[model samples]
Target: MARIPTAELSRYLFAGQIGHRGCLRASRIRIAPTSSSLQTRQFASHVESQAPTATTVPPTPLRKQLKEQAKALKASGQKKKKKVDNQTVPGWELTVGIEIHAQLNTARKLFSPAANSFNDDPNSHVALFDVAMPGSQPVFQPETLIPAVRAALALNCEIQRVSRFDRKHYFHWDQPSGYQITQYYEPFAKDGKLELLARDGIAAEDGESITVGIKQVQMEQDTAKTTAQPGEVQWLDFNRVGVPLIEIITLPEIHHPATAAAFVRKVQVMLNAVDACVSGMEAGGLRADVNVSVRRTDDKCGTLGTRTEIKNLSSFKAVEDAIIAERDRQIAVLESGGVVEGETRGWAIGSTETRRLRGKEGEVDYRYMPDPDLGPVVIDLPLVQYLASSSGLAPDAETDQLIEDYGLTAKDAISLMALDDGARVQYFYNVLDALEQKLGSASVDTIAVDRGLSTLAANWCLHELGKLTELSNNLGMTHKGECKVPSADLAALLYHLHRKEITAKVAKELLWAIFRGEISQGGVTEAIEANDLWFHELSEKEYSDLADQVVEGEDKVLGEFLRFAEGKGKAYPQGKLMFLVGKVMRAGPEQRMDPASVERVVRARIDEVYIPGLKSKE
Candidate 1:
């Protein structure tokens, strides 16, 4: 394998003019003939003379022979395989690069004081400077710099003490400023590497490690969003304008599409673990542009082929599809005697194809000069170190501690923390601490925060609370912010369930009602009582009487139960047994009797009446 520059290969791959002849040129091989052919012929003739009257056949051409051999090899399997003549088929390699843009969780925009929020109203968050109005001057927000530095530190990047912003000029409807204020020449952070682990395939040590070299991580302002409608003019929303954006440029080290997707997912997870990004693919909070190129394996990987940039791959599936389609397109072009052109491509998700967007352009020659209106971003080393230390706690470390301290499996801990944002995780930690205090010191020793509280909170929030929020959103009953079911209420519900005051099922119902705003005060118990919802608990005599009545009312089911208890029936029919249980439960106020207990009681009565020799457990 030869080393190839990602840029050169990307250009050719995107150009799409590489021809089949060029590919064949790289696969050409040399061959020589020897006198062994005559000797072999003479020996075959002597052997024929000594045996039967058969003539030896002449040898076939090497290409034809190889083709036949290849066909035979393929025929031994389930499907037909294409013939690859080493002399004519080119061996290709893929090199992948990525540029990731993460939105900073800052309160204000990079150059403006407008709120950095995903507001519904368009252009409401834009300032004069964000729109590049005449006489508008850029004033850097000192607050945005800390999060940027924290993000760099999280990625293990070296932070540059002094970084400057440059104007990247581009013309687009969403770019109302006519130029993007970005870091081009002097970035705040540089030279980091990410180790990516493969999600699938055999665990081969050689292929497991994928090192992504980070060229730079710079802070920039996000462009406004554009909403398009057919036959109507596109609408621009400048709400995202001046929003702090971090652009991370990676060296072209990825070689596979699936690998690229996995890398992106890992990066997303890492960013989300901290509060750097929201990691919402659908909302475009984090976006990626994939740079892909191909080359022959034997040729120097640096003998650059055409490269193409797949812009704004929002989802992991889209990233994988774009890479595959681009690779196939490049191969098809090369096999057809054409050259791949250097260009940018847009992934048409509907068609599952890549279409040419524009010719490739180098880093914009905005003649980048430091803005005269903005001063150099100076980082106080002590402040940076303090912020880094106070950056709460990493989810990974918290998750590990939860696993160790809470007597939970690492897998369970990871699952619990998987989708939680840093704020949510901290909130959960506080909830768990409160739970520990309430339960006393003995409970703390026996119950891990993860297993006792965090795990329950994770399930309740992800399943119950999430379901309620989704339902409320769908019904337009409440905005996400207003659908407030506090963690404390959830903890209270769990505590009630833990104390056996209410069952898990009843607690879920209470939670649903509370989230629906049915509860006005107190907790779930008060809500349940106020709603006149009560769980019926039958005494021993009541249950005995109900069992007797059920036996008398349902002779057929009773017979079946007797047979099942005697081991005479074909099987314990789940459908028939459940039907009987339902009939009995519905017959009286004990309608909510636990299904398992009902089954056990029915089975015990059947054993006592029909199988006197065997115990109920038997």
Candidate 2:
């Protein structure tokens, strides 16, 4: 070891403190000065020193200050600008378009026979063609195309007679091939419209309907999925590669963020109804890319402003929120005299701002060319016609049919269709089917179907079973075969209630008991008998006697009723009258007593006894 000079050692220590990266600057470092140092305090300073004084103006009186503040507030109130609608920005127009990639529910991939799945072991479902192996040719499967056509029909799109595929040239780690196969130049379907009404769960603030135009729906192959940490080794799953995907493009007609969300929801319902897609968004079955632009709302605004793309919004809420955040960002930029640059942006989870991902890619950047391997997809007129008529009903049509045929209200019908992704609606129909089978006919003569059985089923399915699903951690009721109670049991319970064999209250009690496993027997009738829940009709005279006893015992309520009836009281004793009815029902066999009959008897007794007494007093 060598002894270093004092100044050289000091310099080395300083350099070590502020590393070569210059993370810490010398000016930021602080050092205490000693008497021997250049920056030192004066020696022998006195304990007491005279302080310099400055002149000050008098403070304003509190009252006068308050008066000035009040005047300022009044002036501000008078000059306050008009408030804009919160649903939309003032002096600016927002336009949005959505590009959704929905996976087709087919057994095989779009170009190979590998099973189309997402949950299988990584790379287990990949085919040789998926990996782009040497001499492996792409075999187009018709199974994938059928569902695409079905979805197009459900969305009211005109099927193209001849659609061709093109290769989108791009190099990525996940994409083994040098290009992606998509229907870029000629899509399969075009010019469709989706009607969104107030009852469709997505409506304007004024409850007006919006018709969103569909630009095109094209069939394409999905790229392989990649999952990795930042600056780490990437894990690639080729199972998603060559999977069937239908790219649904909408015209930039949407103006509101919430409306954009509603559009995605409506499309999900339609796809599910047609069995074209079964996996929900949580499972990566569908994803949306939002394109948004904001322009000044003035006469000078003729052309649209620059648009930016927000990619891979997985949830509906994310879609709406991302649009709002990006719209506001663009508006702020334009208001600040800054040009809105077109770029690809990404929304961080739980953030209210969009971050730039990259500059927007131009079509020329893709270098798209006609796919040399795959031929043109030609659709026959007969097949299209058959699918148009034979496919499952669209969500709107299904809702309408439910409202009409089953005599259900618009609210209840839409709710049934919306619950658990339409699984509860199927449960409702299953109950109806079970009831019809038990009653032996679908005619009005059947006691079950005659008395709005479908409406009854809908009510129970939503209120009762929906609550059960919520209490059970939402594990049941959304998916078929996961309901807390079987549909057959529900049908049986509804039968008893409708036939007057059991009261509604008893029906609810028995339903919970069944769900909680408190019932010893499996059948609803057996459980009702075991729980002593059967309904019994009371005669008119028996009801009158019970009411007379109740009225005689409730003298306080009787006096109140009399005073009110004779105009000597302030408010009517209607609630007290119902209280009396409750006492009468309790005085008798409450479970067996009909509440409506008891009420009628109680009201009659009150009128018969109190009204006459009041008349005599008058």
Candidate 3:
């Protein structure tokens, strides 16, 4: 809670009724109706009243004088503090828009023959044309357009039949040429929408929807990397200079920071679905610049305050924290009788506040002009429709279908979809299919194949076998073909676990044996027999006698139970009964007593033997 020093406040000078310090006049400062938390003070009015007359003289500069007055005015009124994590910022409205640069999934650069890989040796992948010599011209890569269409279709963007490229000029160490090539006037896609399926960690209730908007998805070239050490001079690596990127621009439809984070996650998931991009924000494959602006709670969009753009957020956590920080920061500035200015800012991953990268008077013109060399690219309709059809096999569509076809809960279906690689995801569904087929022939109730086996398959894949198996992605291998565990063995293992023929723990042991190739595929019965992993379930008559023996033999539990039945002691009798049942369970490891049955039989024996004996004695 450090106060802004009087001297430090001088840098916030802006135009209007306020023109630095000497320009303060008799104009009134009006803020909108305040919430109870901010307790908005009429500090500007107070300062106006305390202004010097025309005849009066002061030695200090106008900027310094205004800063001192502004500092003193903010301290006069105190307000109630609101929780940082609170859902609503009562007096203010937040608007956020994200711009993402997703690296395209291609072998070479967008306009050059350079290889597009992040891990290559510095400048090793750069072509001579990437350095942009005087006579060089740009050539378009046809293969890169496929993933771009996939992204646009997944986001529900309207595909523009013809889009042209423009030259964007900027002076930076990262740019090889004097300017970069991008889609400025005519982007290939526009007018897309994404309706979020969740709200604040909860599934969207029936008939509740929040849709963030996409303004455009433009293909552009990435810049180079500038490597700088603490004391050494900076060095530029042109390896990534002309790498292709799909820039997805969104309208300012986001209010909550969590909503913003979830939106980014959804985009990343979709990008992965099409193999469009690696989309690893941490590794710079995908990154975002977030624009945040605030207005009064009742204010209309036209009157919204100036925005601050936080640039190059590397991860989703960074995106969330940066938005929250900028939101509260703007509120504090406005509450302190200062105007929020539009500026470019940088946010490090773990930083508490954003740092000003550069100041902005308004928008900086990139001087965009159509590229003379490259032609206006026309998107083929059939190609786009094919991508849309191919995306049906993606996780989003597949997850919903799994829920409908198998009657699995939405949570279970999503868990199955979160399994990363395509092969692993396919393996899960295939095993579920195999188990359903096996159960349909062997069981009386065919419905168990759909409901019971689906749940069992998802559970074992996520919990028991999933935790033990390693995916190709985890090993940093890009190939997504085959996984370690065979689907047949997994199906058989879940079958035994579902039937209570083996404990879940025992099932895990058997799965690992098959994973190590110690047991062959479709060898669940052989593995159980060889390893004594088979478990037994007690019949009703046998469990009844066992429960009777447990009550008779455990005298300590009986004393505790009898006193509790008479209401003479303050202990729970069920705990003692469960403890006695656990002892019987340990004695017969071969027979894995269903815990629900043990508890039921134990309670019945207690009611029949202990309570009735007391009544007979009385």
- Output the number of the TM-score-best candidate: 2
Judged by TM-score relative to the true structure, which candidate is superior, 2 or 3?
Answer: 2
lDDT of each: 0.64, 0.76, 0.70
| lDDT (Cα) of model 3 | 0.70
Number of the top lDDT candidate:
2
Order the candidates by TM-score, highest first.
2, 3, 1
What digit string (tens of lDDT, one per residue) describes model 1 on residues 273-367? 65677444545788999998887777754666778899998776677768777877887898799999989899855233599998887775445
Per-residue lDDT tens digits for candidate 3, residues 336-384, read 9999888999986545578889875331467778899999999889988
Worst 10 residues of 1 by lDDT: 27-36
Write down the TM-score of every candidate: 0.68, 0.73, 0.71
**Model 1: CA > 4 A from native:** 1-94, 196-211, 256-259, 295-305, 335-338, 348-351, 364-375, 402-427, 430-446, 449-454, 473-483, 531-591, 595-618
C-alpha lDDT of residue 445 in model 3: 32
Error of 1 at 397 (Å): 1.7
Kindly indicate the candidate among 2 and 3 with the higher lDDT. 2
The 10 consecutive residues of candidate 2 with the worst lDDT sum are 39-48
lDDT: which is higher, 1 or 2?
Answer: 2
